[model samples]
Target: MTAKQDAQLTGVPSAAMTSLLPGPLVDDAWLAEHLDDPRLVVLDATALLPSPRHDGDHRSASGRPGWAERHLPGSRHADLTSDFSDPGAPCHFAVPTPEALSAALARLGVGEGSEVVAYDTGGGIWAARLWWMLRAISVPAAVLDGGLAAWQAAGRPLASGDTHPEPAVTPAVPVLRPRLWSGIEAVAAISRGEHPGVLVCALPPGGYDGSAPTRYSRRGHIPGSRSLPGRGLLDDTGRLLPRAELAARVGAVLGTADSPVVLYCGGGISAAGTALALTVLGRRDVSVYDGSLEEWSGDPARPLETGG
Candidate 1:
């Protein structure tokens, strides 16, 4: 059957009827209460990010085994490195086409009406990527506030092994929000002073300053971009910081909430974490550079800078 037919059969609404929840982040208590709701779809969007010293081959370094071993009850696995990304792209985890994304979500029983709650074992990094992808398609979704760590800390039940529900139907026509992404051209423009926005590098300080071991074509970072590691947005326990603290830290780099912001990391994974933090902090005009340094550093024409 055609995607539209499948969507109609499964009760997936069209674009006009799509509605998002009030907040992008949900606490463990909120998720526990809604866990058994028929309309709710929980996804363990866990991924093991590539090490700085390794090339951008995330498929070989994924956390799928952990998901198979244990995950939140009734949650399905969403593989960011493979299933949800563009396999043909030059860099790892390139955003997939709307059709590809819709198919992946459908396989996980996520429809237009499905209220998705995405979480990860690696805190919020991978989960936020799924959340951002859902937003791109106008699907209503949220991230589990502290992910698996928080849920386990609360003594929640866990289920092992894989679970496959019947596929869900969503709108055949997916909404692609261009503004939500910054392409290489956009980054180049920003680099050459042809575009206006604050470029935020979401890697670690070592990665930002060229002191970290790297496997990219070049070391260093995009010149003029501020270094605000995505991990800094979270506490030692992996929970996000309080709103006041988040506002102050991000505000210090962004200057104003009205300023356009572009977030990028090694291969666009950690960047999503910062994007999620910004969303919780009430920043509206934020976008992720999909290629990030993976694409930037690989190009010989692009310039890189070292040191703070």
Candidate 2:
């Protein structure tokens, strides 16, 4: 395979990697070099386990039990089912309140302007959630390319620590914003194609096709939505592809940064990952379908499109 093709397949890059996305994702070697850099904070956004299979298992869902098992040195857990998301919400893991998120950040030593890196066992799928959350809160962060598995494969050293990173002082609320999320009513009105919209199923082809279901009310996707699978942005190493390549892949499928994109997945976690990728690709007009298929698919009046 050609060098570029190999990079796409494995999601790993040699020393020199560049991206059109504003921020850059670090690999295991790079991360190891800066593990002690106070300016850089690392996080593990592994999926909350015991969840539906779609969430995957980067870490166990048994709370701190999973984190204690093993993680990047000095890294803290960003529980998708708890920390940055609202557990009481109907959308499964909807974005948490900015106030709650700020607190979570303080605990993670992620104050305003902190450069953060996140990773999960899978490719960027779970790690991207944290990346998106930081963006949503206006914190500058990126996912570690190739995740922990990649780090281990490279024969990198691992650290097991019982001590947690001290929290940072709460900073101002994050300024992260995405295209306005439409509710069920808005979705119903917009699906007629009058708005020139793009509804993206952030899950893999299987999830979008109803072949692999998550904790959603229904198995299908929003009517007329396209499958872009946030997971596609990652290479075999579980790291993000170079920015230029990612832009080409994501832009070609969704049009361009200027195109109106609405992203969603089982609940909204995975969709956030896709939205973050678009934002990194310089797409400013993207929004997350917060209610997503979870809210739209079961309604008799709403439409459901099924295909891989």
Candidate 3:
């Protein structure tokens, strides 16, 4: 076969990736080039919940004012409180059930086989959470490599006016593989180092220590866990570093796929970001400690260990 045909047959794209990001996850340029691809569905997940901190957030709890000011020409907003959240779940940004998630995606004009790209302005925390939700539902999706900042830096076109997408034809409930999830019980076991695994602390140094994180009621991480701040994975430009650098940095903390790697942050949001990084690095067996330190430290029985 010709080189191009060979590459395509092998599931690798013909050209070298312009950015360090994987082909499945596009950068600003790639997204700009494919703006009219018809297959792309971009979602803007850029709002804080309607809590005391809501108004302080740029999105103002209802809509992302920044997105209103300017956004990717075809992007639709994903309301955190209304669209992609589980009201019943005790934790913040918990994964909604399949039915709830399916309905939410349908409203956002996402359907089966849609190439969904999610983004947030800040570090990829919000975008990564939604991307994990999509994967949980068996939808083909990914996050924008560096989010809105990168997009605007590349001089991409922006549009005004609220673009309401037509409702999608809801497909059958996807047959999801119940993996990549760890509950409080599993986190407890990790705290005791019962299973003997790697625990990633994606929080700031102070939060990773015994000091209570501002976001969570309790602070500190599971016993025997290592403090590998999620920011270490990002570059000076706020983009994920090159794969080789990421591999090197993560190699010490993360072993083989067979070796279980449990990740957690204040309330499991940043952990999802780490999980996505691990996924891009081709570690398939990784799972997020969903309850994270929030649930683990809630109980007095669980021992808390501070310091890196």
The number of clashing residue pairs in each candidate reads 0, 13, 0
Tell me, what's the RMSD of every candidate? 5.6, 7.4, 5.5
lDDT per residue (tens digit) for residues 1-308 in model 1: 65543332222433544333335888889888878887788988887754745533343456678998988988989888788999999888899998899888888888666778899988798999998887777666789888999999999898898656566565345766667889988887887778888889999998899887776777798987898899999997798999899888887877754658899988888999999898777566789999999899988989999999
What is candidate 2's CA lDDT for residue 12?
34
Best-fitting candidate, measured by lDDT? 1
For candidate 3, give the lDDT of residue 259.
63
| Rank ordering of all candidates by lDDT, starting from the highest | 1, 3, 2
- Which residue runs of candidate 1 sit more than 4 Å off their true CA positions? 1-22, 54-59, 168-172
Best by TM-score: 1
Q: For residues 98-195, write the lDDT of model 3, one tens digit per residue.
A: 88888888788777656678888767767777777777665656788888889878877778767565866675376464666777777667667677
Of the candidates numbered 2 and 3, which has the greater TM-score value?
3
lDDT for 3 (candidate 3): 52
> Against the true structure, what is each candidate's TM-score?
0.90, 0.79, 0.84
**Reference-based lDDT, each prediction:** 0.81, 0.67, 0.69
lDDT of 2 by residue, 96-173 (tens): 777788788778787754668888775566777667666555565667777888888888866776578567566656
**In angstroms, how far off is 132's CA in candidate 3?**
1.1
